[model samples]
Target chain A: MFDLSTPQRQSKKVIALYAFKSLRGFIFFFVFAAFGMRGFLEGLAFTGLVLFVAATSLIGPVIQYLFFKFHIEQDEFILNKGWLFKEKKAVPLERIQSVNLEQNLLQRILKVYSVQIETAGSKEKELEIKALDESAALSLKQALLDISNQREEQEKTEVTEPEKKTVNPTSNEVSSTLLKLSFLDLFKVGMTQNHLRSGGVAIGLVVGSYFKFQDVIKQFFGDYLDGWEWENLMSFASLGMLFSFLLIFLVFSIVVSLITVFSNYYGFKAVVYQSHLELSMGLIKRQEIRVPIEKIQSLEFRTNPLRQWLGYSTAYIYQAQSDANKASKVSIPACKKEHIKILQETAFKDSVVDATIDIPCNGFSYMRLASYIMLATLIPTLVPLAYFGDYNWVVPMLIPAVVIVFWSYMYGSNSGIVTDKGFIGFKKGWLFKSFSISPVFKAQAVEKWDSIFIRRREEMHVKFHTASGSNGLRYFKKDAVNHLLNYINNTVIKSNRNWM
Target chain B: MTNEQILTHSLPDIESFSFEKHPKRFLNKKLIANTLYMIPLAIAVGFLFYNFSEFPWLGWSGLGLWAFILLFSLFVNYKEYFVRGYTLREHDITYRKGWIFHHQITVPFNRIQHTEINHGPIDRLFNLCELEIYTAGGSSSDLSISGLDPKDAQNLKSFVAGKTSTHV
Candidate 1:
């Protein structure tokens, strides 16, 4: 059933997105070619032959404009249409946690933006509204603010209408704070992020696969090798392997550098609206990411070794938006260090806290880290050696195992948590650090855990869980972790404000 | 902090939970509780009843287990009704379970989302009900407060709700 689409707008600009439009058609054409069902495309071809219609008109853009329709609602944003069925949802403003706006090269050319409203759940309750001119999209943010203000009024009234102290609810708006990343800030971010490792891994896989495929050709198509001693070539295979490894590591690092330079430096701009923070960047596939002021679990200005040396810092926010298996990582494609603290202070404008949280790691972290990392190397060696008795993969694996052990040491050494006047920060990881955060009142569950192993060593793990995210300190001296946990727990409990 | 200062600074005074609201014979002695645990032996008895003609030995063992369980339950119930006592701290609600394990969980009032008081058919006959508390992070962390009086359970619900992050 299709309901009528109702939209509120600051202006009359809508984005018609063909997210996978060309790909969808291409796939359908190729897949249907097996059964000789290329009717529509062939028909178009035949008509082209008959009419000789060359560049008569470009109707693709005209046709796409007719396919999509969306508009903002009072408390939510709405989209209506269906090649099959139209679905409409009443997303209350209070339920929405964040709104992200993205723009690509095409959108930038059109001077438009795509807005996404993320609600509180796993169901992807995001209303991805695209094709709005930048100014129209900017003004649309006011609608979101208006609704959030209404939700606050409702909460206050739901508690005690008669006890209302404020006469005007709408007058007090959450002031917006904007953070911008500079070239050096972005450069430092590129260096500190896991972007390099992943790029290296991808290069390895591609080169490794290319070599393996060529080797397969030599085996099955020996004549193609042209009397090249194919049968006795197993010994010299290590040359190919070594060369591939070097190529991956080198090419990957270069690519990583290029990506970092391009992504962070292109067109980065972060703006603070009344209730939301929006960031837009990307030279090619431009993107805009937004965060609600309330859902921001932790925000910080971080300086890694390289960044510290360069005298620049990166700003990031660690929000809770993931399953327990995969916590939401910080996003700082690139930014100057000064912007991070500015974002933190300005994001919570009226909050009383003017402090920070500190994280400390003990020697046990190294032990814990090593044990987890060893699994990567140990399992492959033992399994293949036991089952297939193959030394090819096992010998190659030790290199990765050694590298992992070194990285684990770095990770364990760097992890720490800090608590200052009103703010608390828990920093963990070395290669890619994740600093989880919270206002003191958000601690949902506090526990001091000591295992049989830890008890003997006089060590402990203290954790404080929050609604969407958790901030924890592990492998600390038992008393210190306990005191911190107790203090935070008591601090959260004593506050009259409710945290959800 | 001084005692008086601590009192003023601590969390809200969430009271109203009392022992009079728990089920009769809620707690039990160690030996009697262990013996009463044999009630699940009735499942084995049911298996025996169906094949009693084929396995007469199993039928006899099942009956012996059932008799032991019934007598032990009566003894256990007597001790539990008289021996156990519980206390509620100002900000937290504590539940003490077992004669042997002797462990207690103190749940702070603000952290509790909602409490559900449910009674099984058999529990109804024994005037026993279980109060289940659900917290925010999914389903697994739910706390079950077993063996509480129905009336006190209602009062505890309101008292805890007053301190909850959400009103309803």
Candidate 2:
């Protein structure tokens, strides 16, 4: 066991980790100075400047490693850092949400691991220990979790029976493996990723980097490249060459998608403990994530057409989050139906399995489809009319118009709600289907929106807000919406279970 | 559970609650703030009219548009004051605002993370304050109720704080 009461520094290997981090930051500056200022500085002077900068950067990490210290004091976790401007932070033990361990290639080679401590809310600054041996990291995590569990039990005892303080058995150390992916499953996961989205992102990155490179060239050789137009250069390419270029770009994007999927999800495994779940994965940068079962607000299962055909869906576990941008979500890829069933059972017990009543959005769905059609065709119809000043241009645009109408109709018809006594679920999307389920007791707020038109038509939109996110149902009958809202409100008010 | 338990008729309905309107002095404060904002734009148009003799139509039209906007906004503010209301129930508080696109949100006291009372210079002049209630459900779900008496805001804050503690 590691002593956590006294202030302790990270493993000595952290010095090397900090030096490499600083070197990565300075690499770009060094390259730019070497090439951009070659005509202005002598070779000897340039070498001396580089040596001095490198030496100073290395020394900064040593000082940082020497000053950083952390320890557990009373019921708070305290961290002290900085040599000149000392900073101190103390987070209450009960406020800690999760402790994760991560190991990158460098840390693995050095036989060390980095630990990340996240508190309950996004407002709390996350704490990270640069390097720790395996035993030290595990002991630190165990100590923090034990203190948090003890405080929770104390609170419960105070509320129920103050005279008797019972000590429970240490069953938290016992865990069972829930799911593990084989090499074949990993390959299937890589193959079934959303290729179109990855391709769009790759294209965006290429375009962005091209523009940045152009700016750099203009800065360095502005006088040599005056009066040069990119349009003239692009006009020289033939149609055949353009087609082949597109083919190459498609191949490149597919390869990038495959690489990303394989590296991030290799050797994935999930284990269930008494009150939490642990997930470990990755090829080069391994991550171990712990999510407390009670903190989970919602569970989402999503799949595309190809994945659905292959009997695979991705599961996303959303926990209580104070900021939407920093939402804590753990995604498990290539989960079959059986795996999803087990996960759902763990998160929500039998509530989801008992959800049988289905409430489909039907009567007012036509109005939503009409609005979608109008919005989608507005730009396409206007651009042709404005450019040509003829009704004939709209003839060619009718093909795309029909496709949009069909897609909107499918979208409206596919969306619906499902509910039971203890859980409420929302199902949406036609091509990219998703089903999200949350316990009725986790609802934080309820919202009802009505427009003048919808109000006159006796229809409304309802949203159920949770700590993770919200689920919305649009164009529903007023009476049904009122019933659902009342049921949710009653459940939230009566249930004494903790929301987070 | 039986079907009778699922019947929602016996449950408390949010639509049936009676909402209370803001104090009348809050309307006066809104009008004063609106006029203060218009004064600077009015002076700028006047300055343009005096400096540019050749473009008299430009200055006159600018002044006309400015006056129209100011009058329109004052009318909207007055009408909107009547439409906005709030209600505090045993377990939750509901705030409803907006006229054309109406929306109502209800947040339970048990879910609130913290509360704050804000008193701006103009609000102080009117002896009013605003109460903000935050939850772990992000900024959009947080509630901000403006135009309240200082004592009432403090009482409301303490009541919510007490309720939250019991839940914890």
Candidate 3:
């Protein structure tokens, strides 16, 4: 059992890590300056400057390691920190959303883990315990969970009339392994991870970086390009050159994407216990997270055209948490489409796959989408073309105009669906499709808004605000908005169930 | 899926629901407060005009834009006072506001994390208060209804507080 009253300090190895991290910037600056001014300065002065920065950075974390202390009380976790300023903070146990345990390379070598406690509050407020022994962090987490459960049980007993003779059970013996991904499964996911989009991103990055440092690079290659002018750079853009460039980019994007995916999701495992779900994964940096089932706000099943063709879907579990760490989204990526159906049904405690009542948005939504595209892209394109009186720009502008029209037509055909059971789902996007399903009872609020355009066309935008975030249908028929709002509000008023 | 429907209640007519409007004096208070901000802005523009007399078009355009903003805001404030209203139900609260872009937000009692009553300096002058209802969603409150009578705001706050305690 973990004691609450005794304050504890993190592993002493954290001091060295903190010192090295803090001194990195100063070290880089000194090294760069010493090399740049090697002709002017003596070698002794450079070595002395390096020594001074290293010694200065070492002082702060050493003092901090001696002063930082933490302990847990009955319902709150208290942290006393700051070597010079002396600051104390107390976080209530009930407010904690999730406690994450992570281990990086340094932590693995030291045989310790870092703990991050996230609360359902503002983004600025998060508690971190760096470099705790693995066993100690686990025990501390178990103790905090136990205390939270006890408080919840006490609250429940008080709310209900007369306590039962039999004490309520705390833990269960049966634990089911919900899902596990193998190396082969990971390979498939990497192959289908939108390599085309990654290619676009890589091309953009290379172009941007070259332009940003063009002056430095040009000076380095002083006389290498004796007759190569700036205008001649694009003038050499033949069809053969473009094809070879694309081939190289394609290979680069696929290699990078596969490496990134495999490294991040090497050993993923998901298990379902009595009341919570546990997920552990990562290759170089490992993390373990626990989420209470009741805290889930919505389940989003998403897939792009490429992934759909490969017969895989990604499911995201949005829990009631502060949006500080967007990377904390619990996801089971590249699962079979059939597996998604089974998982969705099991999580929602209802049947959702067989529903055949998807209603598409108003047909006029196409006009709205097209106008938006024109205003965002074409209107700005015309500004410079008109100013420079460039007739050549008109042909280039026609290509994007045609592409925009096609994109709008596909996107505007999006739909919003509500089952007879009051489960709401929204289908959005064209190339990168995303589908979100939210239980009506979990919705915190419902909003209906009408702009002048929507009102004139008798359409409205209906938004379902959840604890994690919000999802909505854009420019649907007015009557459908009323029906959906009433259906959702009725579910909340009558269910008498907890939202979180 | 079960054959039984999840929606039990007969749909209420949203348009037919009676809404409680703010006091007419609230409009005057808003207009005064908004126009008062223009005094400093006008003073700064005047200083710029005196110092840079060479750029007559710049000074005149800045002053003209300021005057236009002052009059436009007065009209918008007056119109908003009429359009903004709220309705309290047994299990939920609905706030309807906006003119060009109309919005109606309905939040249930169980979703409300807390409630607060605020009396700003200008609002206190007119003996009015604002009731802000917060949910666990984020930094901003879910609903904020301003220009309410102090006693009414107090009563509503307590009512919401009571419901939140019972539901949560």
- Candidate maximizing lDDT: 2
Q: Per-residue CA lDDT of candidate 3, range A1-500, in tens?
A: 44557898887888877887787767657655755676777778877877887787898788888888889876788999997699898888887777889888778777889888877655665788888887788987877776776666566566653354245545534577777889888888888788888777877989999886565566677588667887887998899999998899788989877877777787988777765778888888888888877677788877887787877778898887655656446888876766667566556766465454366775458756776867688778788998899878887887877777777767767556655466787777776777778788888888888875667677888888888788877777777777778778768777666677
Instruction: Pick the winner on DockQ between candidates 1 and 3.
Output: 3
Using Cα atoms, each model's DockQ against the true complex is 0.09, 0.48, 0.37
Best by TM-score: 2
By TM-score: ranked, best first: 2, 3, 1
Query: Candidate 2 recovers what fraction of true contacts?
Result: 0.68
On TM-score, who's better, 2 or 3?
2
Q: Order the candidates by DockQ, highest first.
A: 2, 3, 1
User: Candidate 3 clashing pairs?
Assistant: none
Model 2's TM-score against the true structure: 0.89
**Better model by DockQ, 1 or 2?**
2
- Writing each residue's lDDT as its tens digit, candidate 1 over A1-500 gives 11223543322333223533444554544444523544655766655643432221223433444545655555555655443455655677676666566776666666777776666644353567666766656656556655775676667667656466454654344444355566765555566554556676767878798785664555567696776675667666797788997787766675676576566456677777654567767777677676665666556555556655565555566554534412333355444445555566555542322233355677456656676768865986679686976777775767777776777667666776667655566777764455544676655555545554455665666556665555566677755764675566567557656454
Q: What's every prediction's RMSD, in angstroms? A: 10.2, 4.1, 4.8
User: Candidate 2 residues B96-120, lDDT tens each?
Assistant: 8766677888887888989999999
